[model samples]
Target: EPEVTQTPSHQVTQMGQEVILRCVPISNHLYFYWYRQILGQKVEFLVSFYNNEISEKSEIFDDQFSVERPDGSNFTLKIRSTKLEDSAMYFCASSERGVGELFFGEGSRLTVL
Candidate 1:
């Protein structure tokens, strides 16, 4: 079966630096999303993209965060300026539609110091 792929499973960065996390979502899915979980908190939705634009973005998706589909299979998240609080497991997910249980990658762990 096809599955989501993430690169640099673990990333360590300094505060105020920029980082781009990469993901390859499931091949046949039409909707893509990014969610993050702090060490001990609930998973929160950051943004959802479809048709080459953002469909919905949560309040947490501020000016510093951006998402892009650089190519047919690659989806990326760029954090222009990281903060200590930005440390978390950044999860990439995709679904057949907007309302469904998403299939998630193991995740890209972001640690900012």
Candidate 2:
């Protein structure tokens, strides 16, 4: 069995700084997504990507945020500016089918100071 992998398991950054989170999904999966969970808060969907383009995005994925699949095997999320509200556990997930179960990566925790 394969799973999604995330880099920089933990990140500590000053407010207003830039941050990029990277993830690699299972080789055979197609649908990829980025989701976040603020401490003690519910997991929220940030964005979904397919066919190298954004398929869906939530209000949280504003102008300050962007995602890219720079290559066949990796997906990345970049935050132009860090805010206290942005501090959260970011999870990367992928699914073979568009509406089925999503295999998730161990979250990358971001702490904004």
What overall lDDT goes with each candidate model? 0.95, 0.95
User: Every model's Cα RMSD, please?
Assistant: 0.8, 0.6
> What lDDT tens digits, residue by residue, belong to model 1 across residues 1-113?
88999987999999999999999999989899999999999999999999999999999999999999999999999999999999999999998776777999989999999
Would you estimate the TM-scores of all the predictions?
0.97, 0.97
What is candidate 2's lDDT per residue for 1-113, written digit by digit as tens? 78899988999999999999999999998899999999999999999999999999999999999999999999999999999989999999998877879999999999999
lDDT of model 2 at position 31:
93
In model 2, where is the ten-residue run with the lowest total lDDT?
A: 94-103
By TM-score, the best candidate is 2
For model 2, the superposed segments whose C-alpha errors exceed 4 Å read: none
Clash list (residue pairs), candidate 2: none
lDDT of 2: 0.95
